[model samples]
Target: MPVSLWAMEPMMPLADMPAMVLTPARVSQPQSEAPASVTVIDRNLIEASGARELYEVLKLVPGMTAIKVDGNVPTVAYHGTQARDSRRMLVLLDGRSQYQPGLSRVNWNDMPVDIRDVERIEVTRGPAAAAYGANAFTAVVNIITRDPRDISKHTVSVRGGNNGILDGRAAAVGHGDNTAWRASVSRRADDGYDEPFEGETRPDRKRIETLNTEWVWESDSHNTFALQVGGSQSRLERQQESGVADIGRYTREPVQKGERAFLGLEWQHVFSATHQLKISTYGQYNKEVTDFGVCYLDPFTGQQGPGGALLFSQELRELYSQNGGDTAATFAAVPTSGPVLSRYGSLQGVAGVNFCADSELDLQEERYDLEVQDTWQINDRMRLVSGANVRHDRVSSQAYLSGTEDNVSYRLFGNLAVDVLSPLTLNLGGYWERDQINGEHFSPRGGVSWRVAPGHTLRYVYSRAVRTPDIYEDQAITNIQALDMSEPFASNPEALLGWSPSYFFITQSSPGTLKPEKIRSEEIGYYGQFRFLELDVRYFQEELTDLLSHALNPFEFEPNNEGWVKHQGTEAQLTFRPTVNHLLRLTGAHIHTHTNKKTETRIAARDSGSALWAWQLASQWGVSTAYYFANDYNDYRYERADLQIRFRHRAGPAELEWRAVIQHALNKEPIVFEENQYQEDRMWLELEMKI
Candidate 1:
């Protein structure tokens, strides 16, 4: 039977921040209703934007700040917290977690699913750890792909962008009685951008490719079986800003590669009109290898610090020496002869110690889950929906430097919704999850929506969420040079202040003791849409406890349950479709957040906000302009604003697009300047084709 026939109530397609009403009377309703802050990026929108990579399209989404720290190295900031990694947001590709086990970062290159194969992307811009598990403190992104029934033909496309970027995408679908199959593949390559910090420009090359295939079969009765397989590989070569003086004139090195493969199978069975069950299983493998030639600078003549500190200091010394002044070291070259002291002072040698650091990580994971959901209609005036899911995840990771660790995680979740009146609906959801890392949590959520008028809706929500510590948070092992020694031994500037003579110490600790973080949220909002115009507005407040942040002075990050950080914000969006071919969209947000020590009255105040305006002239032409403004809370190094513009045009299956942006658009001089790190303006462009 057709899937649509399975709906006993109206059903709305999953959307981002929408109040769309489903065709009521569907047997199996969506597990959760769309929140007012959710944003849906469908395939149509992806194609219209002419984005060549995930970062380009994701940047427009509210509450997310994306920047290229260096060519080929993109950093993500969500909810005012930025990280060199991109794992804060939970990203799911067809219900499979895209995060590396135990690590709180995401590898964008592994996200190779072609836009052509995507049906829609659902974004929930709030803590979603309750529904999606770890690394969802800020939001959730669910990428739902095209079902076999929705893709019934063969299609192919090719694309090209500035900087030698090239791409090819293809998909094919076929069907036999009661069965359907679809396959898709995408390949993309780009020369990338120049390393930003230094005067020398090095090659920024990147390549990514993916393949996915799916098979679905419907039995004569009420049963269905589906199987899916997907894999991706990427190779990148880029310059490390600090290492720009390593080899000859450029510190550029080839990042050998990163790869991932996944396989999944799902089975659904319906015993009767109001009873159904679903079973899903999947396994994944991922690997990464980086060959950064001289990736870590030797500390003999450089400041003793992490892999990064030594490089920066050496580069500076080189730059000064090249100007014909007294030179200690220069970006041009490292000295061949010098007294070298081991970080621990146990080993001593002359210069040219020749130390090379290589890192490799491998991960394997398997997951199994079962869910049962149904809607029972008591009458036209009343109905109830409920469902429950049980899932188990087993994960293991091995790294050349960090060694290996294994863990198992499990969760049980359910949701309830009821129609209390002709125009009012009430919803409640709860879940219990446990991980081998010693974190177990129970989360509950509740909300209501009322239709006060024919075209207007009002809603309010209050939810509780929890985040289990991540793998990295639980078991990460790394080596760093200690700068501030508070113990009996400490030193800097090649001088006094410690028992140890003239050096930094290597600190090590077990990472599995950190506790979980928890959050409580409260929100109330309203939305309505006129025939041609729509407006949505919302206000929300959230509080977090046991937040974990790393500190070098203390040498170890102890859970700071001693404070509660609060985030309160207002969001508004206006959209208008004057004609079938014209669209105008405006979105803006203002957030006020304060962090305080629970034991003290002191507060850290941060004010951050952003606004975006986009105009779609037609299905083939579009343009967008956006501006962001933020204030510093604790330091001047993190404060700035930016202006951005994007343009897209599609002509005969071909698309052209460009993004011109200026970070620190106001050119506000850094109040506290660090020699190697400073804010600067940049420009980016991309262009694509479909056949």
Candidate 2:
């Protein structure tokens, strides 16, 4: 059936589409409009799906990918670009860049606000480095909270389900003619699925509790001010140890926890009709801790053992010695100025007789940002858009077992846009960004969007982005080696000392000398609407240089010079709405990537490819089922995987959801050299409500 383009349309006029997230100042309008690439995920879409996390919500979006390696720690990829080391997305809460300078990655667990309070998510899926600066390689996520006025209702929600999952949320807003305030809190816990592909997968568990509070004062349309304070604490217990040698080996005790907090203030002013300015400042703090069991050595047998086990064994041995048996000292550390110490010495005080660890990773960050954006209507047929952003940032970290490091950064960025013709917009943006840790860089961006028809648009974009090195990659000094030195020196005690001091490489020494990773990305896409159908398609490719790779061979690994990696992908989405209340969407994607070098000695290739399909349905009554198929990287690196499913049903304001994810669904055995490269299967169920 052929139908008019206006047969199916949103209730609101397109020009008045909510600009709370992708604000009017940033969006590219038709002729005589600002020029930029922006995508807005509305609050309605959020409530309809009842998504619990950002990862699930981003799956349906174009030019983006949210990865759940463990279902708890999420990572995002934008454009056709995959992360080489750190996240390439610059995520902002309101107007403050929520970047952790110490790690060069956002602590997903520490994102202060719950999805419930999000009014809209404005995603610029390209090198916004010119405007956003650091970590804006693949894209930027601008999370805007709801206005306090519209959220006058108080609501509370609670849910529980499989894997010991439990969730609770509460929110309320108070609004006056000139003053408004909002407060919200949300908590979720789950005994997550076991580590897939690893043998004897044990249940990993995580809990996140978040709180956000804000106050806004507005005077007419020219002046507005807001102050926001947000905090979140998430504790994760995975089977892997923080400083352990091999993550795949050994069943470590559950002992990992992470916590974060943030506070921010913002002010906006309009000076006349064509100029506006916004200033924002924010501070954030994060702390993480991990505990591994104690370690010790036996005296008589000269064998390694747990601290508790060794203590018990030593007591028995002492008893035997008192009864005229042989006495032996397991670990005799001769103090320089005192008698020889007979007890074991903890590794840098992280290990002890009890093996209870207090080691922690801590980061504190502060930022001040100022932006001036203006829309100048030069004439009836042409408009000009220009803006400048200045940012100052400080990041500090204290590692419980290691030491401390601090870094400071500053950036100045600007962009210009011109509407060439009616319904056509062209943009050119660029920025000069500098960081204390990575020196300085210049990133440039160009984009064009054309309204080919009444309800159709064609767009092309090219941009350059950057990713900074993290403390973990730049300064983390590991003592663990792939070939256990102890095994080779079991017979001869002095053999271990023969290893050179450079055996365990230290990649970083100077702080401000590391270079930033660079990415060049190009994209073209089309969006069209006809009758009950809407189709969107995009194809993108990203070229990367000076990428960071975790090298299994320490001797060959270096920072910044690991060569290049490439990521390319195709995305397509189709939506069909037979009626106002009945809507269905189908999304498909194909991603292919390759690194300059392989991470393993046995594998000669560092390439991976995957194809995925997702289908969704919606109605007011709320019963929807989705199917997903994923084929793993088809190389010697890892084995392939298969289909997954999710089902959801809503009763009242409460929603019940279920997920069944299978890893290596088709493969039975390990094709790679990795141990226990086998299939992983699990099912999860969840229930949520709103009051």
Candidate 3:
């Protein structure tokens, strides 16, 4: 329960010592012994950054990119591959995967745990599927929260910022002889984007409330049991609007709201000093309530000749399905954006439709996961860590998935680290999975760590991994129907049914016929530790095949494994804390990508980096500054500088603190999307009390 017992404990570099990590190999070892490169962001650095969201803190990692896809949805990616849907990156919150199995995306800001509770973050900057399972393709991010005993008995904090930002948080801790518990709650709300893009209103606002609780019991000296319960409710504003058109533009303002809950249990038994076993089980439930308006054509009453209503969006939806989702003939069968409209005033574009009616996107996703791990210190020269997990996932969605889709998957993984030669360690690991949809898959890794000097190490690694398609990617039938948003339909239509055809049936599906995306990676890395400096650098080359990308059809939403990309790059991160009064951190990445597809390179930032400097003026006064420099990728750049100052004072039995932060965007260029860029400077003020 102490701060020193972090998952990847490096002791915060207080003295001259190499940081030990557990994520790289599932066993605790110093950075000099690990086979891969890793970046550790501790609690001190996280607080010094003055970031309110987890995604904002992720920018300090090398080769890491964080952006918003839909203006409201926060997405973080490593190597900038597919920033819209970072399917290749595996994210974990206290060992539980954060990758959504149904939506095939990660909701960075919708996590149940508040950022204030996080103790540290460990980032493995390459393929780590051997220790983890399938989704650990490009990188692995592990967020570890603080234990109850590490914090005060009670604490409360609130912050208000420019551009409609507000947050309120409270936490309490209690303990008996052998048990310690903590409970925390937070309410976060923000008005997304400072202004509207070109024409569309910036409707990317969000409101969320979360509750997280943890109980750790030392049943005995040999057995420990830990339980965690968490839940969150969020309302994320979503809207889709089109440009100017002769048929009158179409817009769908849908409020995507959802509830997420999870219960996790872990039992750790220490048989002896050298041997230990841990069993973990968790169950999660996610329910999303959302609906959007649709405008469809009455197929029975509308024209149905060879070149009639059949060429509209609804008819083409069925035609594309009946003939397999590979061809674009159906989309071609319709007309492009022009004056001549299709029959029955069908959708003028892919997502456009004339009229509208009510529709609901309601779905429930459930997951049951269980895993057992064993760590054995066989002797002085060898160590073994092995684990296996079984998972069952199911989803029910009438609006998107027609009905229900469920599957059960299993994985077996293990790693062995041995001192093959003095000053050299050989690590070998593998993971094998029997997936319900992706079938049988295997990931393997081999690495060698050579300690050349007292505090210097050189490492070489080769790894192969795969990413299975998600539930929606594997099987989903998404379509909606409405009369029209305008004009004489039925004054007010009834709920959606089988009576009419669909509108804007831009479905994204690939059932029973999709291969998992695979990656072959090789890297040369180095890690060094000194009295006041810690450095990690890596040069990697990756070849990816069978990547999930859009099908040939530009109008429809279908994903297939037809993309190939090769990347050669280098990334480095360094931390320098010469004394207790000053701290400095720097990170940079140079990316060179070779790919024929434009979609693959949409977010590949050629040269990107970040820097942070903090100063402790007095015992109660502190100030920090941060700079984020980005590339001109996608014809847009985000360069920003931030200054944060804080003052702490003693008041009665509680400690009072006041903090302020100001951020100035230097480039003033559009961000991920044209509608998301903010040119003005942002400011925030916070007040906190601890007892």
**Quick one: best lDDT, which candidate?**
3
- CA error at residue 513 for candidate 3, angstroms: 1.4
Question: lDDT tens string, model 2, 171-196?
Answer: 87788879999899999887655335
Q: What does the lDDT read for residue 667 in candidate 1?
A: 38
Q: After aligning candidate 1 to the native by TM-score, how far in Å is the CA of 502 from where it should be?
A: 24
Ranking of predictions according to TM-score: 3, 2, 1
Cand. 3 TM to true fold: 0.89
lDDT of 3 by residue, 174-214 (tens): 98889999999998888877766676577778999998999
Instruction: Tell me the lDDT of model 3 at 119.
Output: 85
Candidate 2's C-alpha runs over 4 A off are: 1-39, 79-86, 194-203, 242-254, 296-302, 305-358, 361-392, 398-404, 471-512, 551-557, 599-620, 633-691
lDDT of 3 at 462: 98
The residue-by-residue lDDT of candidate 1 on 408-519, one tens digit each, is: 6666655556777877877666667766776577776677878787667787777766656565556654332223322222223232212222211222334456667677
Candidate 3 clash pair list: 355-484, 355-485, 356-484, 356-485
| Alpha carbon deviation, residue 185, candidate 2 (Å) | 0.9
Instruction: Compute each candidate's TM-score over C-alphas.
Output: 0.72, 0.73, 0.89
Better of 2 and 3 by TM-score: 3
Q: Which structure is stronger by lDDT: 1 or 3?
A: 3
- How does model 2 fare in lDDT? 0.54
